[model samples]
Target: MQDWAGVFIPLVLFILLSPGLLFQIPGKCRIIEFGNFHTSAISIIVHAILFFSLAAIFLVAIGVQMNLGP
Candidate 1:
């Protein structure tokens, strides 16, 4: 019974927050290298915090409630 916001919002957020997926912004932290790919630990943590905050805000704004139990 959920609308588009239920699915679409999280999907977009996931893509945007996933490290080395869409964009790579290596801030002051050292970049970890494996072969040709590189990513920063600080950047990943920042993205995770940002994602959680945004997701919470969006959920509240969209009036989506969660049921924890059956």
Candidate 2:
């Protein structure tokens, strides 16, 4: 197996920071509107969920690949 620490450490840090970085960005489009606390929280939650799901997929794929290797 791969070293779990090495595999997961950066993912943990990135997962923590990226979603909040959205708040620092400012602009509006037809799809996204930046605004008050409630809306911002909802958007962040959605982003976190999306990020977590993608991360899980990647981690699972990596684990499978590692398991299949010598």
Candidate 3:
């Protein structure tokens, strides 16, 4: 139902972003030897943005749903 859309959007977004969040692990291991910190820094920023954007979108959706009532 429409209620489910509220839950599904964030779930789908999170699932899609999960791969990007994990993509730098091997690169991180290799980069450690070279003392290169940029890989991890970029990964952190990407993940933080992904997570916060999803959270903000979900919050806004929920707020609108609440304002509209059940």
Candidate 4:
């Protein structure tokens, strides 16, 4: 349970935060251009912030502790 949470939670966050996998933020040029479909630099930055913020809120809501040492 605890071990699963530790691994699963961060893995989920990483997938969710990955560019173009979940979010399709638009802008001028593509962050990782693949023909026509692509994401922009500014949009990537903005979405990264948004995703991190949401992740923080979620972690807090789930009462996940962040400790440095034992």
Backbone clashes for every candidate come to 0, 0, 0, 1
User: Least lDDT summed over 10 consecutive residues: which range in candidate 1?
Assistant: 28-37
Q: Give per-model TM-scores.
A: 0.56, 0.42, 0.38, 0.52
In order, the Cα lDDT scores of the candidates are: 0.65, 0.49, 0.54, 0.61
Top model by TM-score, which number? 1
lDDT of 2 by residue, 1-70 (tens): 5445435644764654353343312223335433422334555566667666666666665542333235
lDDT of 3: 0.54
lDDT of 3 by residue, 1-70 (tens): 2545466666766665553333443355553223233355566666568766876767675553423335
Task: Give the Cα-based TM-score of candidate 4 against the true structure.
Answer: 0.52
Candidate 1 ranges beyond 4 A from true positions? 21-37, 62-70
Per-residue CA lDDT of candidate 4, range 1-70, in tens? 1335445566787776666666555535543433344566776787688777766776756757545444
Residue 56 lDDT (model 4): 72
| Candidates, ranked, TM-score | 1, 4, 2, 3
lDDT of 3 at 49: 87
